[model samples]
Target: MPNSDMPQTRQHCYAYPHPAVTTDVVLFTIRQRTLSVLLIQRGTPPCQGMWALPGGFLEIDEDLETCAKRELYEETGIEGVYLEQLYTFGDPQRDPRERVISVTYFALSQSDNLSPKAASDAALADWFSMNELPQLAFDHAKIIQLARTRLLSKLGYSTIAFQMLPEYFTLSQLQSVYEILLDENLDKRNFRKGILARNIIKETGEYSRLGNHRPAKTYQVVNPSQVEIIK
Candidate 1:
């Protein structure tokens, strides 16, 4: 392997500075009929002690989605949940340290048994109700607003609402999720009829007994992969 007589080529590097790229994740869950978002208290300067979405600077070798999941896990001890790319925030003055761009993602999960432990650059990790959010660091408030808009829009068409529910749930529970996100009450008869008409959910042959009242049949999404726009 000593035939290296090709003028000894050298590696090239960019001469000009460039903006840094990072990733952020917005995790949403419903607890006690209230929609909440996961937030981390920043431990470092620029916005120390301020609550923000879980995220960090992207590693050079990592993909965007990979970076997002990794940051989420690192900061909040949460992983293996469904994540979707929400949008990109590249405002030049978004970050005070330097020119930084953040590619944000949104995730949905049931908060039944999941608890967050702070790590990495996070001093604390917890869920805050959407209706009562703390002062957010960076441009996270805007990012979260956008994510909320996307979540509401997607709920009307996609089966993503199920991601925030358990595998087996009653129709009342399912309807509650829609009602919480839509922020309004839906007609029980029409809601049931519309959901059943789509043929998206099927009975699981299980019934939940609710305190001397009639039992409610449990159901699960027929095809979690199928999404339909319902009006």
Candidate 2:
């Protein structure tokens, strides 16, 4: 029998011009009850000093997801959040340097406490609230809007919002997250009723103490790693 493990010969397929591939990450977090996203000021040419998403040209051997994670960490010193592939943008003129296609990933992170330092083609790293974004470079603003829309659409039918909360939180905190992303105030009773009926969280028997107010009962997501579909 022929050896199944035999190495196949490699050949360079240069017959057709191929565009370079890249992976960009849109890291979102809730800050002071506002929805925010991470941005990097480019330190290199082609958009130097302009704000953009953290990303780089994909190395030939690495998968798209791995490239996204690597680019994010290298530019912003952020990692560990589960990123969902948001979209593929292959417009002929998205990048000024060359013909490049971007596979973008987005994630909700409890990353307010983590400080991001700029490096590796990034001049500075910071979070900007969705309401007040600065001038962005290389079509990054459109990418962010698409990511935000995806998150909003998933909130009603999935447990995706839990990724933005801490391990234990009050129902108010959970409701605030939804309100901030949804951009509308939710009725406390109805929101609580709808959320509790889903059975995605359970009481930790803990209480969050606020200034001069009654302690609010704290709860935890039953399975933080999986986004259970509700409907």
Candidate 3:
């Protein structure tokens, strides 16, 4: 049904041209000990056949976040993710078709097992490692760089990284997540000490044995849905 919320519009009201609005999503997940972002091959023009973030133009009645989620699902088949608004890119020359302003969002996933089936204007979908991204369409590369910087900044004070971890994970696995995202090696003992001191996670009284190493303790976040600053 057409929404009745908008008031009646007159033909002359469209006198001034307004910029087109769009929404793009940057979804990150860990796979094969590497951090990766989801990308889709554009089936239509502007940047046909080029790999880009999953996104599209917003519908007239839909809200910003709804458009973001819809575009992401239509292009990449990824859904039910918690998205955070990152920024707005309003460069007049950003789009070839028209003066387009894009609102971008980002999300973190705990599993990389998702299978992306391309639909709508997407020809293909795949994951690209952080250290190895393909030539992206539009200003997507710039958007990703900013998202990375923001993720790194949040990792220092918030439990945002927990979204990338399983319910029951070892301290080593936790440190690995931080190291992978930060692109640096962290001291295991110190990392464990500091994280445990935050009181965000609790010992589960279970252990995991990885190869020749002895069993390591397991822990789970005290509140899975709580997004609190540990610092």
Candidate 4:
């Protein structure tokens, strides 16, 4: 039975999902003792002329880390490095269109082998000194600050620093990396004592040649699974 007041059939509520879920990779590298972060110039609107971290929408059946690595490769032509999940960004107003939640990842790579080749969609991709980053799109500034802080704090008692360094490095080079990240000069004697006390570095019985100085011995980060530095 149709009633005069009921002029139409029942209407159902349809849900439109958010734009997409994505993962952004914040690749950090230490070159000549200064920390650097990777960024790319956007090729589209909403921040078309701005610099941004490497990222993109996740595939339908991809894992977060996989998506992060893929985006890194796509935007910067880099691959295969130690990457760790940093944090997630989901401020309602972060994206202009629909909601977007980006899972951020941090990675360490060798500055020598990395070559910045912008993807087809990116105007440019390059590494900038961490101290002199330009205005970034989205909440990238906040993400970079957080990553820098975490890297410094963790360096105090963790083996995470090895990720940013080559497999074999000199004590001076290692200390330099610490100084750049911590933003504080460390006494040579004290720094050596702290590192040696950890029993986490093994002398490789090899030496490295430098300009206008005596060759320095090389050392490697002892496997954490095999050595216990801090109790």
Question: Which candidate's TM-score is highest?
Answer: 2
Worst 10 residues of 4 by lDDT: 222-231
Residue 70 in candidate 4, Cα distance off native in Å: 0.2
Note the Cα lDDT for every prediction shown. Answer: 0.91, 0.91, 0.90, 0.84
Predicted candidate 3 versus true structure: per-residue lDDT over 1-231, tens digit per residue:
767997877675676898999999999989888989999999999899999999999999999999999999999888977688999999999999999999999988876447778999999999899899999999999999998888889998899898898889999899999999988998878988899888999999999998899999999999888667877
For each candidate in turn, the TM-score is: 0.92, 0.94, 0.91, 0.87
Tell me the lDDT of model 4 at 133.
94
TM-score pick, better of 1 and 2: 2
lDDT of 2 by residue, 1-231 (tens): 868799878788787899999999999998877899999999988988899999999998999999999999999998888689999999999998889999999977886546788888898999999999999999899999999999999998999999998889899989989998999999999999999998999999979997888999999999988778886
Clashing pairs in 3: none
Q: In candidate 3, how many clashes are counted?
A: 0
Model 1 regions lying over 4 Å from their true place: 1-10, 225-231
Q: Candidate 4: lDDT over CA atoms?
A: 0.84
In order of lDDT, best first, we have 1, 2, 3, 4
- For 1-231, candidate 4 gives per-residue lDDT tens digits of 768897688786769554678898888998667799999999987789799999988998999999998998888889987788999999988878668898999887768768889995788998899878999998889998988877776776678877767789999988887888887899999999889887889999999987878999999988833212253
Error of 2 at 63 (Å): 0.6
Deviation (Å) of 226 in candidate 4: 12
Model 3 worst lDDT run, 10 consecutive residues:
6-15
Model 2: lDDT of residue 165: 88
Minimal lDDT window, size 10, model 1: 222-231
lDDT of 3 at 14: 72
Runs in model 4 deviating more than 4 A are 1-19, 224-231
